[model samples]
Target chain A: MRRILRKHAIVEDDWTLDDAARTPAGLIVPLARWRAERELLLASAAAIGVLLPNTEDVEAIYPQIADRPLIALQFPTFTDGRALTQAVLLRNRLGFAGELRALGDVVRDLVFWLGRCGFDAIVPRPDQDLEACRGALDELSVAYQPAADAHAAVWARRRMRASA
Target chain B: MYRYDEIDRELLKQRTAQFRDQTRRFLAGELSEEDFRQLRLRNGLYQQRHAPMLRISVPYGLLNSAQLRRMAHVVRKYDKGYGHFTTRQNIQLNWPQLAEVPDLLAELAEVQLHGIQACGNDTRNITCDYLAGVAGDELVDPRPYCELLRQFIALHPEFYWLPRKFKFGFTGATIDRAATRTNDAAVHVLRRDGAVGYRFFVGGGLGRLPLLGQEMNAFVPEADLLLYACAILRTFNRFGRRDNIHKARIKIVLREWGVERFRAAIEEEYAKIGASAEGGQLKLLPEDIGRMRGHFDAPPYRPAGEAAADLRAQAASDPRFAAWLKRNVRPHKSAGYRVVFVSLKAPEQAPGDCTAGQFEALAELCDAYSFGELRSTYDQNLVLADVAERDLYALWGRLDAVKLATPNIGLTTDIIACPGLDFCGLANAGTIGVTHDIYRRFDSLEAQYEVGPIRITMSGCMNGCGHHSVGHIGILGVDKHGEEWYQVTLGGSAGNDAAIGERVGRALSRSEIAGGVERLIRAYLELRSDEEETFIECYRRVGMEPFKARLYEAEGESGKPVPSESEERPPGESGQGARAGMARRGVAAA
Candidate 1:
């Protein structure tokens, strides 16, 4: 089992990755495979998850939000930021209630932002330090804009202080 | 001059601590050079030709005296006692060591200043008109909107790592003094339906590919500004090109997908974001805007009974002061005040380079003359935006003593040249050397005034950091067989009428560039309809044939047309601007 940082703690990941030829139970299949095998995957005994490519339209997965227990968004590279918007849309727009996992090119530098973008679980690359990745979540306590994270923006904080 | 509360101060403190640790890790060989480069670039540190240059953010071109003094102190202590003001209204220290940048940033934090998001692929500094509130032609003040946008863009989670660097410029006036059209996104304030809103323009940039911004929306309500911006940036972050580095800017995305398709995509994204529950939380409240506006309220002014009349009399008596008054001073919106420009383009010094002593002196002068406030213009000059009319003579005297009153604000001598081959490792040719030669050729103020109201922009590379594409006479330095040659572009403007200049003729060698410029100007002087016909105006009316005929004719060559660089070689053969933008921000060289 691969250990990942979830909610600021290191935990073992139970979800299995793409094995299109085998049964879809407990496997996070790619978006194309899941779309093609929607009926077959829906009839499975266990809950299924989908792995979304960064280039795919985030809204395409919205209709299937309730059926999946996890959505692993691809980062592709640390500098490729298409998945950040995808995660935000999934959490804020579609109101995805299940686990939001960040996969591929996940590193300590991007871990804080991943959490803010509503990614609950971060699958760090093979060489990344889990402890450091966990600590990166608390890098800054203040945010200038309201993100998927629960923290109030600085302007809201200012308003609260003024009201007090 | 928004004051920082505990939350703001704490945020800066935490950011400094994080960057300090990042620096330590890089030095310890824990982080790779590529990763460290990206990390340090977010904090405005660049590994330049000789040293690590630090670009300090001057948000919207506004700075208080204390902050200016802090900048002087930082430059004096860490750098070689000099800093360069860039065309984007930021100050860059060229000689700071990489190890000591954390200390420098901490010192700057004392004055509530940080270089955060000043130079990176993320949203850089949000810029506004230097004369935001005090300009004669005024609309709603844009500073508060800029502040709000700056806050929202700072350390944004979803848009931090875009395909390429992004820029935003705002202007309150109808004059378009901030060069808003040249930025990646432009927000102009206007009153629509009895309410102050913004007109948003997108996909404008000036690198190897220069394209003017197209209006995306005619009117975005004030409350929906942040939401609309997020929608646009989100669309760009998701779909902008990442395959080819040169084609990564938002402009290319707009080119590939036409404006109609781009607008449809943005509207779809905007609808999704606006319907999101969290999006409501991002809507800017009226009280929030009011609070930010209170920070920029005009300072109290004393009465000015006979100040203008007395200044006029003084100008009539002193010719030098009259020249300075005509060129360096502008009318202010306030009754008793005038907008004063402190020209950094003195004949003796490199354009935009100021010494430590000059910075300290400017801070003191700002305190004495302009209500303890000063601004940096995108034209590489400084402004005392609120000087009283009665104090014009005294201010001119003081500025003259410090070599700041050159009386050449928009003249040919007021050249904008980047820290080209001297400091920028990406530059192919030298800009400062050629600029000084051009300065010697046009040495007289009377001569420059005779040929009036012209802008000459030069860049050592095709990055267009010097904004050569929008200059009246643009000179771009190209490399030919390891020797420096310059290509001239004619008839460009950056104001409300923004247009990319057209390349005029063949490239000139290093020795021939200055004389070629002289011929271009001399042609204008000879062919102009009247003295009122500015260089751009004359060029627009008479077209390029007359100037081209004059430029190459004097070289003793036949009048046959020379093949363009594009016909011979690939367009923008180098594209050094992308690498420079990756290393530095938009304003790469200086």
Candidate 2:
């Protein structure tokens, strides 16, 4: 069984993704099917999400699925960081506040950076341990450059505490 | 010398643990070789030709006596008893076992020294004018900004896998002592309208394609420096070529896209990045500057006192000390202080290679005479930045005794050469042997003193580690039919007018380098109009033709690069050269 890490803990994955023949709901579709059968998926009552490839033209896809329940960003390889850019845009530029899940090649090493880049859920590759991923988040107590995370940089934090 | 706070200390400790774990995983056969290589590179560990070479960063070339002693102990205990100082103002141990690097890194963390961001595709140790704080002509000390950049970029997640490694340097002084323009991005700190800002220059590089950095912004407010730098790197990371390693550096991207387009992209990225919520976090707070300046404040100095008069009398009375004084000593910003340069190019050892014994003595001297701090100059010599004028005589005696006082600072014999074939895996030719040969030719202090200031730089290959491209007389080692051939370039300068040296003619053989250098120096001495005219001044006044003519056509006969038969096999049926085709890593044709 696949486990999803949400809010720094293992959580049950609710959303079902079926690519072959779309069942009677709860199916996240690829870009082609989502565009081709857009009216059917949109009108359906079951909650659905879209899986975005690392190379997705996020700007073009943004207008189409502005109100999707969730977005699953795929990392083709851990080293390929295009999805991180897409995630940053999704969170800040497009105001994506709903579920943002990272899947495929989500190794333990990339978990901390992925969290900083606005991913709320991670589905790590088979080789990566879920508990190890949790530990990666607490590795560094300080970050000089602020990521998309809510916390201010350590420098700012240090200044605030000093004044307080 | 930004001292680490509790937060900063935690970050380093965490990073060391992470690297240690990764190294452990790799050694246990869990991680792949290629994966381990990329991971190890960011920590400055390289599987070199002979053994693993670890480059330890000396941030802006600043080190205290205790840190120096620690390095001395580490190197002596680990692999070799010495380390090679690099052009980037870092130190490289030529031999270390791969398995021991993790333990070594843990040890280095104790002294606040590690290989973090010293190599690989990240911002190189932010370099600056070695005389930054102490220089008389400095507008503002660039160290605070350098340290700021250093902290901001170390283990920065976004820049972990840039298309190529990026180098950043800055200088507040009017003269470009740090070779600021050769870096991928540089800041020339200036105070305009009573506000300190920086002039950002981009795309200037030396290597396979060398071009002077173009000024991107005349003045960027100090608050936005880090944000702007981040935007530049992000832009490069997105658009730079990852397919071809040869054309991977930001310079190539900037060149191919043209400066106007590249500038537009960067500005767009900058504005986007600025608009983001995270942007404000990286901005420099006023307290940050105040905090850093406290650490770098000048040590307590005594009044120049009777020492100035005593030194003057000593200079007049003693010719040897006078030569040493005239060459090695320079004025320090503080009263009663003088900067003394200790040349690493001693009699026998390679240029910039200092042994453990040397560091031990130097550390003791620094603690006694100076303020227990030693700064490494970009020219590969060490500096006693805050040496008192009173102790100048005593320090010189000690230095001369150790063979460190060569009296060749900024003179003809003070040569800088990279460890070409002798140590570096990327080198196609030898550098130390040539520097030693040339140094001995101009051995006499009287002869070298009379010849005057001439900058000679040599690189084993196009990877201009020796910074050969900017030398007043640059020598690049090219492999000709598996044999070493030295190519000479006459008019390079790393000063305000930074220009890459142009080749004089065809390349010369290994044996011909020292003789060729002597002839060029002789030509300069003869052609110079006055005694005040330096070699560069004379070369600039009279173009490369005169010097080229003298070296090539002694009696008006075209003679260099005589068509010779090659004993080494020319090429295979594939038409590839005898030597393997290797990508030039910067030596960004400065």
Candidate 3:
């Protein structure tokens, strides 16, 4: 069982990514598999999730967001940051309100950026300390740019304060 | 210059602390080397050949006297007694210790300076025309927009990592003094119809394949500039190639997809970003623009037109001052004021290096003369952007005492050379030795003046940081079986008419480069239609055959190897310098 940092807390992950699970319930299948068995999986789903590769266009899943419980965007490697854009597009553009998870090559150092890009759940690499990752999330309270995060950009805040 | 408010200071404090922790983790072996490199590079730390080099971002190349004093103090107290001003308008300290970098960054932050995004895959420290607000032919002042863009890109979460490093250059004047066409993106401020807007050129770069930017958008309204930039960035982040480092820059992406397809993708992304609630908030409100403009308001200028008679008298008394006045000064936007270029291309020193003592003196001079402000040009020189005509003599006297007043700006002796093999870890050959040899050949100011205005840019390696591709005379160093060789290119220009220089002939040996350059200049002098016809113009008119003939024919007369087709550059050793051999060459050079 793997523990993931979900919304700033390290908790045991209930969602399994194994394709050949004895029961398809709570199984997060790859994008291709989910697309192939879409009708079958939608009927008896106990909480279906889709493991979307970073390369997959988020536009394809815009209509499917309402049904999916989770969408895990793959990082492949920490430096390969195409997933950051995917996560942003999913949360900000497609309006996916479900659990937007980040998987693969996740480190405590990258926890802040992952959260800012709307990754609620992060599967940190085995060596990363969960406590350190939790602390890293709040390392920078000020952001200069607007992202999918809840905080307003500093300029906007400044404008509001000045008007007030 | 934009001063940091409490929010900006807090952000910098937090970012510095984060780097401190990352350094601790790396030192403690908690972070892997490859992982630590990604973290450190964002904070402007690089592991060079001799020591860790820290590049401090002087946003838009604007700095106050106090900030310069702090830089002087930091350089003197840190590993080195000097620093190098890069062509991108950032200052690089080459010998800082890795463990002490966090403290160095902290000191810099006290003066509202930080290394954030200075040399990373993120939007790099923005470069702008050194004469942004002061140039006489200016349209809209670009400093405020540059500041806004600088803040928006600093530590942006989504763009923290991309396929490759990105750069930006901005210009507000009629002339492109910032070399905007050679950057990742160029933002030109202009007025269309009745309102101010920006013309964006994207996919420009100077690397393995040098390419100028294409006009991505003709007119982006002032309010939507940042949003448009975000769209461009998001598209690049999503689609830029990661498999090959050489093919990862936006230029390659734009080339592969074609400008039309790339423009379509950016436009689509722009529409989506503008529609999104989160991104709509990122729009530049009029209030926000006003706030930025307030910071960069012009300094209080006083008219001194009456000083013209005194200036003429001084010039008449001293021919040296007259030559300097002709070469090193430019007409200011304000009446009775001038823009003074303090040349760092002294023959005895490295092209862009300034010692700690010189920095301190320059700081004092800034307080006395240019409204306590200084700007670093992309040509690796400093500028006193708002000096009064009455104070010219006094300022020149102080500058001359410090050996900072070289009167060869854009002339033959005013060469731009990178640190090459001596300092840069990536250089294949030495640049300073050959630069000194050329300086000795053109030793006198009179001799240099004979050649007229020509840009001779040299790079140690093919990374093109010296901007060799755009120089009127480009010198590229290549490694030949443990020996150093130089390749020459002619007729490159980096202004509004940007073009990549064409190769002249085969590579010149280390012993042959200086004389070869002299012969090329001699050919230009002899072949020019008139003295008024500049080197680039004459070269353009006469073409390369005559110059190539002069170089090779002269080489044959000297009993050296003559240029020939059989001696062409190796399959992989073209001036682009294949990226495959980078790692091996780096290790071998070290």
For residues A65-119, write the lDDT of model 3, one tens digit per residue. 5568898888878888899999888888888899998888898888999989999
State the lDDT of candidate 3 residue by residue for B524-567, as single tens digits. Answer: 98999999999999988999999999877655544654445433
Q: lDDT per residue, candidate 1, B165-217, as tens digits? A: 99999998989988898999999988987898999999998878989888998
Q: Estimate each model's TM-score.
A: 0.95, 0.91, 0.95
**Candidate 3 residue pairs in clash (backbone atoms < 3 Å):** none
- Give stretches of model 3 more than 4 Å off: A43-45, B305-309, B556-590
Q: Clashes in each model (backbone N, CA, C under 3 Å)?
A: 0, 8, 0
Q: Model 2 off-target regions past 4 Å?
A: A1-7, A10-18, A22-66, A69-77, A101-106, A123-126, A129-131, B306-309, B553-590
Cα shift from native, residue B503, model 3 (Å)? 1.1
- Considering summed lDDT, which 10 consecutive residues are worst modelled in model 1 chain A? A18-27
Interface RMSD of each: 1.0, 2.2, 1.0
Q: Between the candidate structures 1 and 3, which one is better when assessed by DockQ?
A: 3
Per-model B-chain TM-score: 0.94, 0.93, 0.94
lDDT of 3: 0.85
